[model samples]
Target: MFQESGVMNSEVVGKRRKAELVFQFRSSLYFVTGNLSVNKDMTEENTLV
Candidate 1:
């Protein structure tokens, strides 16, 4: 029935939201790691100087 379909739709939306959140989390981690590596290189150069 219509009510069942509505419930199913909301469940699908929830799953989609979760997937989006996971994607965002992965991208954030990647960005942070990238920044950390760059900072490490800078720190090393500073130490040498």
Candidate 2:
């Protein structure tokens, strides 16, 4: 019983870590795209001025 529970706990931990990594990667990707768009807007405004 103890061994079974330990195995289950490890599986859960591994899944949680994988989920955390995916979330971090997605958020960083979003942030990079957002910054790129903002920079483009700034350049357009400067050109207009």
Per-model TM-score versus the true fold: 0.88, 0.90
Which ten residues in a row are the worst by lDDT in model 1? 1-10
lDDT of 1 by residue, 1-49 (tens): 9999999999999999999999999999999999999999999999999
Candidate 1 deviation (Cα RMSD): 0.9
Best by TM-score: 2
lDDT of 2 at 47: 100
TM-score of 2: 0.90
Query: What pairs collide in candidate 2?
Result: none
**For each candidate, how many residue pairs have backbone atoms clashing (under 3 Å)?**
0, 0
